[model samples]
Target: MTILQPQVGHETLELLTNVLIGNGFSIGISSQFNYSSLVELCDLNIIDKKLFEELETSNFEFVMKTLVNADKLDKIYNRTDSTFLHAYGRIKRSLIEAIGKIHPEKYEIDLSDNYVLNKTMVRHSKRIFSTNYDMLLYWMILEDKKHVDFFGRSHNKDGTLRFTPNRESEKQVFHLHGALHLYLNDGYIEKLNTSDHLANHSSIVELIKEMIELGRMPLFISEGNGEEKKKSILNNEYLNFCYKSLEDLEGSITVFGHSLDNEVDSHIIHALNNAKKLSRVNYCIYTEGKSEPVIQLEMSRITYLFSGKEVVFYDSESIRNNMRVIEFYV
Candidate 1:
């Protein structure tokens, strides 16, 4: 049985899915969801276009870091400037809106071939772990109509589905990096679900937009390195649980969509290294062809990371089929 752990690589969104545009990747996205689109948002939202341009990249994580540093620099210099803070708020709002608009409505996707996706991506997996913060995978669960099996039933008192693992539930999904519907409240992670959409919103995307506008930014961890990501994960119980789950597997695991680079994802590598019983890994890789040398270098890194373990490389096509979460329908 394969425990499918899907994550984005440090760059270019190589994990077969590019819900959010990755820097330096040849991701196919509509004009509405590209970097220029984000710049348009910055202008349309009345955010300082100069400030946005200064960031020099479309990656939200990098932008957040620069804003954070700007805020810190203000304090260090004993200067009182609300400029970055205001821009920061506007950017966060824009970021959430960007995702809301980019996230496809269910009807936009052709769910006709869900069976092929289920047979290949879900049926054989013991557990499914995803690192994407978008709602694509969640939509896939909605398509399957077995969210009860996919999402655990443990609810906290606030009606949010708590990540409480139970013995009877063999099938489970963990949003390891948190999603737009998840937010931190009173030290606990609360997941907004279908009911939230029905009661107060037109769609999940709108619900997410409303939540972020109301200052409930979902727990998105876009920190650069594993240590930074780990620190962010440690702050929330649900996220920590997801990260730690990596070390508990005892059989073969199929790592899809994630490169697990030691520098950016060392925490994950550390966890995998701890899974002593994990005998085999069915790792996915992009077909080299023209990029053979680069792919080989990556394989060497992967090999070095999983030393002494049986790591088998497979073509990216397997997981690429499941990446149908987005563009395939179009």
Candidate 2:
């Protein structure tokens, strides 16, 4: 399927990916994440045992939403508990540590597959917004030798690389949810400047280890529901920037590799609806063989969301079979 923008000159498309982008080279968050260590690290047994149990069975995202609710309750009672606030700090560090352990090393990656994936993305889109925290997307973009500056090269006052997406460079990948290499400090989202010094797999591993040692976790949406996730996204400077940018997208928009699940991803659906100039939406449905009830329901919700606009559905496997090379007619 070829996508063409309504406007005459807009060529390259707006592409978005979630954790389910492919069969996926990254661990991709489907595997059960152990939150037990987080409790131990945070010493929540003495502080709040119930909180630890709830978060134990869930990822940090759900735990964060729990904390947010706790914060609101504290606000209502007019009591400011610093210890409750500080527990998140300890849990966050442990969560980052778990991510570090779960993530695939650079040496474990298939560079050939990434190079092909990179070529496919370059062929279809210029601006790519990804919610994945893994380095697969980063590695694929790095495969483009001429555009390694996707995260920008300019340094900031805090000794971290500035994340200015250079559109002229094309093939810019923006991390909406944050990556394993990105860390949060004083509300400023920072990137681990691995593009320059990363010569080999061993070096990448070393840098990641050093980053973990410094107590920096990925800047991610920790909430369970859409509203909670929305609040978290709006609170962060970079995340808000990414969300608002998507909300304003015009013409043809391709939501590739995202389930667009109405339960947890209602915020993303709303973002697409607010794109006033959205003439057509090219949404990819990841169907293995046949359509399931859940997939059909997801499609219905999307169609209802964009009642007046044209919606195009594509089999995700077809795109993957095509080696990520999406043909766009602009």
Instruction: Report the lDDT tens digits of candidate 2 across residue range 37-154.
Output: 3334443445554765655433454565576677788888998775655666666555555556655665555555644544465445555666656666666565555443334446
* Top-lDDT candidate index: 1
Model 2: lDDT of residue 325 = 36
Clashes of 1: 1
Taken over the whole model, the C-alpha lDDT of each candidate is 0.58, 0.56
Superposed by TM-score, candidate 1 places the C-alpha of residue 127 at a distance from the truth, in angstroms, of 0.6
Alpha carbon deviation, residue 115, candidate 2 (Å): 7.3
Determine the C-alpha RMSD for candidate 2 after optimal superposition of all C-alphas. Answer: 7.5
Runs of candidate 1 exceeding 4 Å displacement: 1-88, 112-120, 145-158, 318-330
> In order, what is each prediction's RMSD in angstroms?
8.5, 7.5
Which pairs clash in model 1? Answer: 15-257
Q: For model 2, where is the 10-residue window of minimal lDDT? A: 3-12
Residue-pair clashes, model 2:
1
